[model samples]
Target: MRTVQYELMRPGELLAEKERFSVAYLPVGPLEWHGPHMPFGTDPLDAQAVARGVAQKIGGVVFPTLYCGTERARTPQELQCMGFEEEDLYVVGMDVPANPVKSCYFPEEAFGMILREYLLQIVEQGFRLVVIVNGHGASGQLATGERLAREFTHNTPATVLFTRAMQKLEEGDQRLGHANISETAMQMYISGDSVDLSQLPPREVPLKTCDWGIADALEFQGLGNAAHTVEQDPRDATAQLGRRYVENGVQRISDQVLAAYAELEPRQGTKA
Candidate 1:
């Protein structure tokens, strides 16, 4: 059967599924550099790939990802390149362009407003459940996404699910951090054609010993550090490992969504 994708589904089919449970997925990623080997849009693309698989198993509509979020450029030159034409030099966070640092763009107030409107619009269109599936380094945004989800759910008759921390799956001794073996492997397994394994750089430092020096030393007065150049060597990454990560990620998210869906029922006044 053809899986439901908002971009590909016909209007009539979408209307037919109005009463049935539908999920709207939003994948958030930054425009900043990942590494020479991986495309700059790696986070968002990887996120969408995983999200599509998860949504397919859950049987819901997968919406296009929202590429803008909290991001920072790795260097002043990069930031200049990204924010070059923009009028506001200190636009902040993901809005600042090629995010060089782990800084989050979109302030709390702005995020709340934007998310609230998005959820309300989805609910108005009859999708009761919404999930913001993000694959970024910053976990704080998950809290923001969850808060918006909870607020939307409480204020309206809709149900929202945010896949925050991966639970129920063992760590499996795989590197789970940014642009590490796991993510690179998943990209190779999922988006192999788009992924240029030769571009991936060799990991100079061990994961356990690496520090958040760049983010800490930013000091709000000087240029931030560029850590995007670092990545797990693709030589050590395998398609098999990528497949395992994708499978585990999909299973974990599906389990959570199914559990959440069972507990949810639309508000009495609103239609499900």
Candidate 2:
């Protein structure tokens, strides 16, 4: 069977794929707490599934999932929004101060260097249209992607696109928060055993940021209120819902990648 997964493909297969389609998908996220019910690698897991779904629709290689991302520390105002008095452990990214296991978070500058290395490597591999499947929703992460997208697209022959997963894919979809129903549903869609709603608190119980998975965290003062209760039920999450998100994400990304590929296909290429 054919595969779009980069790590699984042989060199010959990879080269053939590059000639056929000049697109590469990089599913990026960090290993952070997502709550009790969901896996810790929820972000990248969701990203990989969606990226592969899109690749199959169009044509591309799904790079190995990047489980490292950057986040800025919470400012006084941001901390205040989260109902925190100090920044002792209220740093940004989903690794709440409550969780015992810390996440793999890189400094912004360090992450930028690492990301640039990957981007350059992918481009040098002959992929003219590279899609950065952003799984983590950190402010610093977004800024880095935006900045690099412009730099690489303008300076190089490639066009880099940094897009968040499940953003505006569905007609009335709410913002996909950290380990929220959407993320949980997407994870459920990928693997049933990957999520266990039973592991979570009772439906009526409000899950705090430290519970591990913030399946239903709602903003009260700032964003992702630490004092907020879960607004949705993780039990309501189903593989079917996950499938819808993945399918919708695939379609939206497929459209963009296909368009870019078409425009760049006319460029001079020695192979096929």
Candidate 3:
């Protein structure tokens, strides 16, 4: 029951837990707009909570959540369709728009390189296993972690496990959303005061559809939307549902982490 957070632990505490420090959890997400009801830090916050739970159940330390991530691509045509001018879209980390908005973005290549360096450092720190848990569901961000895991395992002794929390759910049970029922519910459960149901818009906004590519296909099916960011209605969101999602997520991630750590037993012994 030692401190699960790496940044909060004292040097001696870390040493005391060194034997259990074979794994490190890195929760990565973006600081993007959720909605009026939810905070913009929802992604990283959820990621950190899930990571901490996994670390507590297994033996590991959860690093401080990484708030920078790849942004949703906003092509010129898409922007125009959304009725957003170029200037209307504020740069990452900028506090403009004065509304519910903010996205700390980095190019995919840069983000991938950053993750690679992070994994290298984690390996150097003597962790035989690392889990990169991304709360954001962007394809680019997910791919970045997967690519880094593959490349890092090939080049280093560390076994990197990468996944998006929402992706772990079964197809019919998946409740992925921006600030919708699932996300809002999870946030409400994790941080009770962070979400204000009363602040949700009075009515739902329609989302635009696209004609080309898989991204567009998903978008057309209400998977991706700009204005009505919520995938499902938030009216039914409750703290109870959120607890279910959080617990399910923690169980899924913990199982994966344990499986991956077991796979690294030989490598871990080699390092020892």
Best by lDDT: 2
lDDT of 3 by residue, 120-164 (tens): 777888777888888887667888888888877776778788866
TM-score ranking, best first: 2, 3, 1
Clashing pairs in model 3?
Answer: none
Worst 10 residues of 1 by lDDT: 208-217
Q: Residue 17 lDDT in model 3? A: 67
Summarize candidate 1's per-residue lDDT along 160-220 as a digit string, tens digits. 7777322223744525544545666777887787666554334564221022111211223
Q: What tens digits encode model 2's per-residue C-alpha lDDT throughout 1-272?
A: 47999999999999999888878999998887777778878888888888988888778899998888888876766555554565465566656666767778899999899889999999888788899998877789999988998788777778898887766545655645667777888888898798988887777777654444363324523545446545555667778888888888888878877776677656435222
**Which residue segments of model 3 deviate by more than 4 Å?**
74-100, 167-169, 203-231, 268-272
Off by over 4 Å in 1: 71-112, 164-169, 172-174, 200-234, 266-272
| Model 2 TM | 0.88
lDDT of 1 at 32: 42
Task: Flag the better candidate by TM-score, 1 or 2.
Answer: 2
C-alpha TM-score for every candidate:
0.71, 0.88, 0.80
